[model samples]
Target: MQVIDPVTLDNCADEPIHIPGSIQPHGALLAFDLEGILLGWSANVAQLLQLTPTLNTPLAALALPAEVSQAASECLDSVEDGEAPVTALEVTFGAVRFDCIVHAYHARLIIEFERRDTPSDAVAAFALKAHAAIDRLRRQKSIDALLQLATEQVRAITGFDRVMAYRFHQDDSGDVTAEARRDDLEPYLHRRYPASDIPAQARRLYTINTLRLIADIHYTPSPLVGRAGDVPLDLSHSVLRSVSPIHIEYLQNMGVGASMSVSIVVAGRLWGLLACHHMAPLQVPYSVRMAADVMAQVLASLVQSMEARANALLVEQSAEVRTRLMETLLHQDEPARALLAHAPGVCQSLQAEALIVTEYGKLVVHGDIDPELAARMVASLPAHGQDMVERSAVGDWPEALRPALAPWAGLLALRFDPATDGWLLALRREQIHTIRWAGRPDKVIRTGPMGPRLTPRGSFDEWRQMVRERAVPWAAAERLAASQLLGEMHRASVAKHVETDRARAQLLAMLGHDLRGPLHSINMAATVLQHGGAASTMSTRIQASSTRMERLISQVLDMSRINGGLGLGLTRGPVDLVPLLHDLLDEARTAHPELRIDASMPAALVAEVDGDRLVQVVSNLVSNARHHGDHGEPIELMLDERDGKVLLEVRNTAPAIPAGLLPTLYSPLKHASVGNVRNRGGLGLGLHIAQEIVQQHGGEIVYRYAASQVVFAVTLPRA
Candidate 1:
């Protein structure tokens, strides 16, 4: 055998692994038609069969014994569609004994004759060992423990120097989760391997052929001799199929002489593999291989059950936490406080070092975190809950926040509102660990005739690297708990507001009715004083106070009526909106000489609306713009008519409405701060009244924030 160059060997990975067209010399293969005429045979068949068989020769003409021929035909008939070749029967012809396996392939019956290597007495011992392994597996309760037991049992049964349970990640990369090996050998447990190490074709073959055995890595491949014009054989399910050259080279690089792998399948999918490797060339009897296959299947079933149980426990714990948190929130006066009250249990449930709850404009800290740092982390969280749970290393966080967050190396932050600085942060302290790797992960390349070629790394020596600036990974359970917590918080918040609104409405109605008589007397006294001109300055002050009081009282009555579902009385007429806007703009310019107002009005746009109500709506919008608009930019007012509807838009380059404030912008008594001035308000009812009046006239009012500007758009029916 010649050593193939690295580039050529690497390219061989692309070759169809299923159709190797060769078999190990320990086996002889023969292909025949359904009518029992020989179509093809392996090159070594003559040596095994002790006869020269012509192509297309009928079964009756061949020198094969009657029993072997009958068994082959029956096995071929028993093979279902898409099923792999199976050992049908054993036959001894002229002192040569073989196990004959028959399968259907491409309109032909393929029979494989493998010489049995195991003694008859070994079968009973292997069966007993299999039963013991299955009993041990049944006693295990967790997937990890079961995997450990499985690898040990396989190593004990096969007498392999080392056995490992390799589990794959979602990306096809694998990790050695469990290992049983000689004391002198370096451990491969928890060592990771890239997906490229096992090419896609190799993975597919593992599924079709659940068990593969390479007795000797350096064995020569015996070619199969097909009839004239026959295609290469597809030896995908062949027990004696020659292994890939690249895989053999890989094993050699790992200082392995022989290797065997049995696929662990769950729910009809390949879950992982029980991979066994020996320090020297070794072969196990086929009986042991069959027993190992059964053990792997049992392990697969147990693993699935254990994983499901673990998930169920997690869900149960999460539900309990959610229930307690909701109960606390529903009864507590302060929702943020309620979150803090449940912090200890939630922290334990989520497996976090600390938990932070930032809601309702208050920051609540739970454990092992700086209040300032937690606040910053909450502010940095995105507003959307779609990616509500963000897990990252502290070092990877923003540079400004890194120092404060560094102590907690891992951060898992979830936001109830992506548009607001309200979130829940789970922190995990910095973790440091030393990882022992099987070999240097770096690829070794050769500058060959091809620009570059990859070669297997030389040594399988253990390499250690100290890793830091990271945190223990967030588990799936923690993420689930966080999502559940967020949902409960949102529900509680809505319920709180609903209760608050109902109580407030009742108090307002009582206050409105009680204050009416007293307000009437004050108005009468102010009117009398103004007419008599007694204490002229006092008279003027009294009249202005009375007027302001009357406006407040009227707004309260309007709110009460609206809340009671009483429709607003609207007196509609064809009113020209252009003139109304111009008059309002003029009034605005005169009232605020320091501000600039830009107006674009159509010549004449009439709409069916109450002239008084429309004027009030325009006045309220203009006033808001003047008071809350950005000081550096002019307010823009546009009125136009198109497609039988009137469009009135009032836009101002203002400090944008804060995301947190947008939801309450048009709610009654919800005051918005203008620039830096807070509470510069006239009861906060201006926008609310304007919205109600517009809706009554069959119009729609909407507010939009764009380019650091606030725009109020009103669409109404044109006269």
Candidate 2:
């Protein structure tokens, strides 16, 4: 808006620069340098020195008048005296109002702007007021008082009609906690509005950012064909002067003409909104809202501190109460029901209203004496067997509970153990507020010895009501209390289960060990006789049968030991396996005289292994072969090395081990049909131990069957 005259040749040469504002007759100033260069120019400089490009342009193009150019030239020339010129002017850029100031200190000039008209001392005065008020607030300890102060400060500073703390509830309802209104406006304190009035998207957007300003929510947005600017007019921000259409529609629906929502962050979370509302249309400049944002940030930490202190106090109280109750209830020798039956008395002693205990409605008990009325009240509660969970199938708490406890009154329901389906109720009595049980937080009762006020037993009706209430069944708190009480009782009732299992295990272990000693000696004697028996038929048959009986006893003992985790110790050493195999062959020759032995092992197979255990595994396999295999064919033993592991195998020419028995060959002893000597002989411990020992040394025992031949192979890590 400023116009400049052209600079003549003489003026240009005499002055290194003629700043646009100095030569142009506008409300702005400019400074030029001695190098015939315009260092900085304001809006007024546009008349004398026109800029080619708006941003970062040179200052030589304005058609300045000869006299104005001469004045600029003189100013530039005087730079030898360290003096610079300044000018002020009004300018507009793409519809933006910018008041400009230009000043040259040395080589470079500075351009400053005021987007809006300002009173010089308004800012400094505001700082003093805000600082003093905030300093006073900093010394405040009460949250309610601080909230009041902050609302007042915001209303005064912003000149808004209404400034309030709007708290968002889980149900999407909001309550105006602190409200400050203009002198003529009606009060909006303690008013609540459903959050439904603010669409879901609005809440989402509010939380997404810290500050939102709809200077005039009713403002229509100007459509742009690709607007170009650092900022637009928005409900949130205005790079250019256009608001979002969707937001405008949303605001209209909410009945708000103009609004600015400042996020109230507490405990590192968006607690709610500090909403400034104006019923009449109003426009707030960007600078004002930005200041509000800064102020909000200042108060955030203070609010956080207050919330933390309150939460800490709550936790301390809960812990103290829980400790005391647990000491009284959990470890008591008496039954839980008996212990909890006294809860109503406890509540009375604590000076509470209508002491009620609910175990999710499973167990309900009340210190209240209106037994019949209490029963009806509890029966209608959203309670089942758990304290906290209202019956989902039924109506909600406020709805169902409202009509239920209309006879009692109090505030602050003291709770305990919600996780385990139990809650203790100790309602505060000093409060005029009525805390009808969940069914009805407003339930009222007379104030006598047995009633809510707990006044002196002046009349007999109070005592009668109390006595009558004691007989009421299915009370919500009583039922819930009973449910939790029952859970505790059930647990306490069966607490000795583990000890019983341990006793059984011990018995098995003792019987197995005690009974095995005699069986072993009998088997040894029978075995010696079987191998060396003469032609005495009776003596030989007796010994053979006795040996089989001994085997059965050993099987039972082995199974008992294995099941009880009585591990057998084994010795590890280098064994010349060729001789051990030879000895085993000799034993098989004596046991299964008809069984032919085929050996393909080396003359000397040395292995770092438990030689005795290996001997047992081999012996068991031989026994299995003699009993089930070689029904008419001979058995064979093969030893070799494969994949760096020593292998020992015993094969039988029978029907590849009864398929049904092969799978369970090394499993625990079942109540199998005892008939053959082999069947009755062992409890499959040899194969079990063999597998275990080899596995201990990183080895395994496996079976490979083909045709009528069954092969039992043991693979061990080779040394």
Candidate 3:
């Protein structure tokens, strides 16, 4: 047996585990060029095939059976360029039958030959077992359940003393998540192993070759030989590839004489491993290994589906929360207050302990946290680069700030503006617990011929450590949700600013157009009257312009007072609608003589209301109707009382309001007709003020389009 000294083993990371230069003695490996010129052959090949390696020797000279040669050619042709090995082919060479697995690597055709001599009965039995195992794995609904089922099924099929399902962590380290073994053996479940245990090259090999078995650690490696040169063979896809000496030593230290590992691949990446171990040298049949490989593939597919489904659901939920938050923020005047209002929902939905929003030197915190410390941290955080950062452990944070953040171990933060120090941070509290490790996980160095070499720890005994100041790691879903929240917040802030700027511009325009224009006309008319030029006409124009200016000013004041929370100061009294309607009809006829006016009402319909405010509501509604109504269509008003409620309808023939603009019709200062078919503009508060007054009287004003007519409908309690 060859014992690699500590120096060679120490450089395990640089070791080319893929090109071991040798292979297990039980199988033969052959490498040839595209023209059938023999390039390389394992030392065991001569004994197995009665052929020796020679420079530029054609593979056909060996006289391999026609069927076997054709199968080999077909296998190579079927494999696409740069793809993994194709399925193995059963072939006969003399009296020995073998499974011929062919693949191309670095412009060389490499073939592995594994001897197969199982009886027909054994083959049939193994097939049944393989099918049962696949069926059992398929029934598992979740990734965890599937892994557990895989471990148990592989153990039963391979008959190994211990079987464990090990999963890789984000840091390349791995943990034994599920295990099934003999009752007397120690359990390896939940035990974490350092990344160094499996070298980088070894991990790459695991992805290429899904199943690997070491039937006997003590068996000698048969070196591949060529006619000339010192070129080594590449055994990357060889099932009977020789084991790495360092790995052999590690297994020996752990009292494992034989082992088999099957890679669990998800979405083309190595996700984990199903490792089988035995205390004594044991040979696992090729059939059993094949069955284990099939099971691993099936499990990998199921895991991918489950994860995809989970991610979709999380995305949908995050979108809903984002929509709700944006709607609330758009309606708010202050961003800080808006975020505070939805703080609880945000925290709960994100599964966070606390939430913080810091902007422009202002800090608002929503849950358990040290406000002063959080403020300091927020100020110190980067104001550029990545928009989001998530960390499960904050141990590397500054020592000065550690005490303040000691209670929390995880953080998810999103910056709304990369150029500004504005952030939305979600916090997670620290979790302290005990964890079991397979060993001390500390690398050891030993003196060797070449200075020293790093080696795996000598002990496999369980080591218990108390883990502290570490919170539950933030999952990909939570990070995605945080990103979505930041996007929505940014949009809301932009929209609010736009709306604010627009409203300000509109107010300025109202002062310039409605107030200034009318006042200027009146002033010009007064000058004309003073000069004795058409005094009657100028005087009439002055009176009409002044009245229009007064009405505009009064409406502006009413909207301002209502928005400022001032009560409308209504005096309840017995008001007669019939007399009021008749007076309003006469006034409308005088104001808009070109259009006809229609009114429907009871002879004596009376209700308790503020006579002045109710009259103002009616006046505003009637004026709006006359201005926006079709030029040739009559304006209609209907008022009635039933079931202790007063119903009022103002209808006119006009183009239907755009669906998108209808919701904003009752909003203060919103011009629903800005770009519509009719653009007669005002302060845009006529319907707004009317709706406010009716609500004060315990009523609602609704606008709807029906039968080619636009209608303003108000329903009020008779109070």
- State the TM-score for model 1: 0.64
Q: Please tell me which predicted candidate would have the highest lDDT against the true structure.
A: 3
C-alpha lDDT of all candidate models, in order:
0.75, 0.51, 0.78
Worst 10-residue lDDT window for candidate 3 reads 672-681
lDDT of each residue in 1-719, candidate 2, tens digit only: 85534332222223211111122121233333345444333333343234332432334444433434454455455454544554434445444454444433444433433344344256445555666667766876886777777788877767788898876665455666788887776565665554443445455445545676555555433221111122121222111223334335445644567777787775555666788878776544445555566566666767778876765564454444444554445333222233365554444333344554543233344554455644444444334443333221112324555454433433222224333333444432222221111111121223334222211112111111111111112233333333444444345434423433553464456446544655565565567677885436645555565665565455455544533335345567888888998997897787667778788888877888888767767877887777777576777889988777798888988765556665445544322322245454444445655565565566778888977788888888766
Predicted model with the maximum TM-score: 3
Q: Flag regions of model 2 displaced more than 4 Å.
A: 1-115, 119-121, 227-257, 279-285, 335-364, 369-394, 397-719
Q: Is 1 or 3 the stronger prediction by lDDT?
A: 3
Model 3, range 560-656, lDDT digits (tens) per residue? Answer: 6764446476788888888987897897798667868888988988888887788788888777777788888898999998788999898989988
Residue by residue across 241-315, what tens digits does model 1's lDDT show? 787765787899988988999998876667789999998977676767889999998888888888778878878
- The per-prediction CA RMSD against the true structure, in angstroms, equals 18.1, 27.7, 10.3
lDDT of 3 at 26: 71
RMSD of 1: 18.1
